[model samples]
Target chain A: MARTAGSHAETTGPKVRAVALRLFARYGYAAVSMRQIAAEVGVQAGALYNYTPDKQGLLMSLMQGHMHDILEARQATSSEGDAVQQLEAFVKFHIGFHLARPEALFVSYMELRNLEPQNFARIEALRRDYENELEGILARGAAEGVFTLDDPKISTLAIISMLNGVVNWFRPDGRLGLGDVEQIYWGMVRRAVGAAE
Target chain B: MARTAGSHAETTGPKVRAVALRLFARYGYAAVSMRQIAAEVGVQAGALYNYTPDKQGLLMSLMQGHMHDILEARQATSSEGDAVQQLEAFVKFHIGFHLARPEALFVSYMELRNLEPQNFARIEALRRDYENELEGILARGAAEGVFTLDDPKISTLAIISMLNGVVNWFRPDGRLGLGDVEQIYWGMVRRAVGAAE
Candidate 1:
């Protein structure tokens, strides 16, 4: 049955989004249900409709919303600097930003297909923007002759590939600290970008 | 209700696994189920049990079995060479092997968590061994200074990351041929591990 304004105010829209993000990260989008989300959030499945019209809406909110916020955050923090600092900020942000929200990273990365075609296109554009962010940085560094790579597209794809790989194996309780993780990835990124002196 | 089988051949163990892989690749592991798999394989849900015990077993078989076969294929065709040649061969194998069997790659990489603890550990070990294959090459190259990496583990990890990222985007129908894909990746890999000329 469809729900209307009968839902309670104690459960806000953002709370529903947070719950959905965590569940999608754990169980994936298709594997999760309105009932499961409601059960975990202490609301009725119909109450979830108070926030999202459907599960696909929840996934779209999780991905496109999170990515938009990420792009905004990176934009706000970005500064004009020497190519190295710009690159460092980009690298650090890529690593630190993802570490701060593993759920968002995992779910957004894993659940692209669950979106409606129009929604998928929007989310894909946001992700492509994120990819292009570093491509610009690499192109700037390369144009200055400080960086040496044959093709920025291949190099950009490669650097992103290496950086994104960090999420798969990173562990806070493991021997490495987050700073160490950043530095190690930064080191390799430096080499790959021909930034190391 | 459980399925009753007349003979061992009546069990759809292998057939179910095959169908699961194809569907998991095309749709996704999370979106698939025993019923869907059964429907595709032309078997009843009850008949699925003859092949394996449960959904998790089917996922494990797709993963552990796939990795076993991948390792075997590599062992057969994998050549002995200095770290550079071995690395190229590994890159070629990684791309060729995955491009050929996207279904297996999709299931193994995506459905890892679906495995029970023992099953997860066993498949993880196989993954570690595969990782170690690249690590061995990196370690050899680092020792000879053919690879000027600050950390072999990072190089190993990064190489695998770049290679695996191919599956997320590569399409046979794309303008880039398999050989073109291999060449592009090899150029990046060569620069990554090439002797400091």
Candidate 2:
């Protein structure tokens, strides 16, 4: 009996999160309920509690998971180059990572207002850490005289926002492949930062 | 009595929209109900139908209204200048207009998925029209050899996305004033297209 429950929970935990994310992304977070999430997960409402304490907990977990995933993915990529190369890697990584997880990206951006203050701060910190990575690249480039920037911090936000906009309209089977899109953006980014050719 | 009723609706119409926009921005559209909107508008639930056919209509109207407002605002701005000057106006106008109406911008972006298909199409057409305005400038600039771009269409989306990001974190009281932010972004925009100095 104990072994069965343990295995069930291991499987069910992921199921609960998946269902919850879909429902929340489809409908706004406030519009989704724990009971509804449970129904979608094929579990009793009581069983959901065994996986997540409540809706807020589930939201925080999803957001935090997204942040951590992106940060980890960013960490795994090569950062062993000059500022221009580092900036290129950052741009490509950001676009590819965000494109692959549209739902998580949507939820993370859209549901920010719903996060409780404490949860908001935690998520913001993680986000800042991510932003800081790009800012660091810009700063290094500016310092090395390879790139000209009025404000590295503002440039960081502008570059990320421009890249994030890709997920809004990019289709994998569209006329342009991902590589083409990345190259186009990198060209613009390189120019935008006044990077040396 | 008819005149009085007409006048009442004229006054109440904007209120209903204002309340709905605020509520929808605060809570996702699905989580907000017609009754909640009516209550906030200080009217009976059924009376909201007089203002809007249903919750969807309200959402559609808000999104449509936002698009029209921006389009009209863009039209009002002077498009008379060299391509570089026109692009500068666009970047500055975009950031200022969007920043001034954060709630509308937020709802317009976040509730796009919630728009009914027909409504979505209408809003998209308007958005595309807005995008084309920028594309025209880029095309002109490229043709005139004032700006270099790999793809004018892609560059248009990228520039607008970068500018639209200002609303996400810009504060009037923050370290940068609107003018300072605009100038910084303008510099980046000019460089991003490889415009002649």
Candidate 3:
């Protein structure tokens, strides 16, 4: 009986998170209640506590999980080659990953202000780690004379900001296919970083 | 007596807007209430309605006012230069304008989802107008061979998105002054659009 209960919890846990993410993305985090999340997950409000401690924990878990998944997915991509190649890979990977998870991307940026101080710090650290990955590529490129940049840190931020905009407007039925959009952005990013062709 | 009443309303109207902007930026629009805004404005909840019809009206007013002010400010700047010069002016202007009014910028993006469908459409139209201003510059630049871009529309969005990021992290007393930040961004924008020497 205990094993069956544990198995049930394991299946229900992900459903709670999925519902929470969608609701939080549609309505800002401050406005969403744990009761509402539980309702959407087809569970009683009391059962939500068994899955997560509270609303804050739900938010932190969703955000931290997103960052972890992003980093893990990035690692799975083929990152072989020079800084230029790696930067291109980073750009393409970021656009594709974020495009597929628009809800997560939206909530990630929109709800950062709602995280508790400690939770905010932890999330920021995780984000900084992801950013530093691209900064490393720019630094490597600049060192090898393959790219010219005044500040790798600012460039990293600028490039990511530019890429993040894709989620705001890209649609599957848009005139430009994903490949076309990626190509255009890749060109602009390469130029922005002053890559030597 | 009527003149005095008119004068009082003129002052109170802006106060109401200022308070609403601050609260909405701190807490997402969905979470803030009319009572809270009125309390912050130091007026009775009913008095708040005299300034704006409802919460939707207030949100729409703030967003529309922001876009109108942006377009008007852009017009006030010297836009008579060539495409490259114009793009540089845009980069500097956007960064300065948005950085100075971080609250409005924050509310503008974060609360966009909370706007009613009609209000959202109107605000988007106004925003598109501002974007087209930049797109016009890029199109002209491409025509004159002063810039190389596959799509002027995408480049306009990319550049604006990148410049918008300055407000996210910029501080008045940071290591980089406003002028320094502008110069660095100008360099990147110039490169991103593929401006020729």
Candidate 4:
């Protein structure tokens, strides 16, 4: 009986998170209920509590998971290049990473207001860590006299925001391929910072 | 009796929209019901239908009203000048206009998924019209040899996304005032298009 329950949890846990993410992305987090998630996951409402304490816990977990995934993915990429190379790598990596997880990206941005204060702070800290990585690149380029920037922090936010906009309209079968987008956007980012061609 | 009914709608119409917008922004659209909107507006749930056919109608109206408001505001601004000057005007106008209506902006982006197919198409058309305005500017600048852009359409979307990002974090009492933000953002916009200093 104990072994059966353990294995059940192991399989059901991922299914619960996946179904919850889809529902939350389709309907905002506040609108999605634990019972609704359980129904979607083919589990009893009581079984959900065994996995997640409540709706808020599930939301926080999803959001934290997304942030951690992105941060870890970013960390895995090589950061050995100069500021311009680093910035380009960052742009492509961000666009590709976000594009691959549209639902997670949507939930991460939209459901932020629903996070508890402590959870919000933790997620925000993780976000800041990501933003700071780009800011550091801009600062290095400016200091090295390779890029001219009015404000590294603002530029960091602006670039990320601009890159994020791609997910809103990009389609796998769209006219422009992802590689084309990366190049065009990298061009704009390079120019935005007054980096020479 | 007719005059009283007309007067009631005239007053209640705006109130309904205001309450609905607030609730939709605070709680996702799917979570908020017609009764909640009516209660907040001090009206009976059935009375809410007098103003809107259904919850979807209210959502459609609010989203449409926002788009029309911005489009009309954009029209009101003078478009006379070189491309660089015109782009500056657009950047400042967009930031100031969106910053003033944070709730509307939030709902406009967040509730887009909740819009019905036809309603989504209409909102998207309005959005494209806005994007076209910026694309025209970039095209003109590129043609006149004042700006260098790899793709005008892509740049249009990118610039708008960057500007729209300000709504996510701008506060009146924050360290920087609106004017300071406009100047900083405008500087980035000017450079992003490869505009000459």
- Estimate, for each residue in B108-134, the C-alpha lDDT of model 2 and write its tens digit: 888988888898899989999999999
- Among all windows of 10 consecutive residues in model 1 chain A, the one with the lowest summed lDDT is A1-10
Tens-place lDDT per residue, model 4, A3-26, is 344457778999999999999988
Which residue pairs clash within candidate 2? none
Q: TM-score of each candidate?
A: 0.87, 0.90, 0.92, 0.90
Q: What does candidate 3's lDDT look like per residue over B112-189, in tens digits?
A: 888899999999999999999999999999999999898988888888888888778888888888888898899988
Backbone clashes in model 4, listed as residue pairs? none
Give me the displacement of residue A96 in model 4, in angstroms. Answer: 1.7
* Residue A151 alpha-carbon offset, candidate 2, angstroms: 1.7
Q: Which ten residues in a row have the lowest lDDT in candidate 2 chain B?
A: B1-10
The clash count for each model shown is 1, 0, 0, 0
Q: Score the docking of each candidate (DockQ).
A: 0.43, 0.67, 0.69, 0.65
Residues A1-197, candidate 2: write the lDDT tens digits.
23344448778899998988888878778877888987877776888888887789999999999999999999999799899999999999988888788788878988988899999999999999999999999999999899989999999999988988887878888888888889999999999999978
Report the error of model 2 at residue B4, Å.
14
In model 1, what lDDT does residue A180 have? 84
Instruction: Give all candidates' CA lDDT scores.
Output: 0.80, 0.88, 0.88, 0.89
Score candidate 4 by lDDT: 0.89
TM-score of chain B of each: 0.89, 0.90, 0.92, 0.92
Interface RMSD of each: 2.1, 1.6, 1.2, 1.6
Model 3 alpha-carbon drift over 4 Å, by segment: A1-11, B1-8
- Put down candidate 1 lDDT per residue, B1-197, tens digits, no spaces: 33445434634566777788888876677788789998887768778887787877777777878899989988998488777888889999999999888778877877775667899899999999999988988898889878877667777887888888887777889877889888878767776664453
- The order of the candidates by lDDT, greatest first, is 4, 2, 3, 1
DockQ (0 to 1) for model 2: 0.67
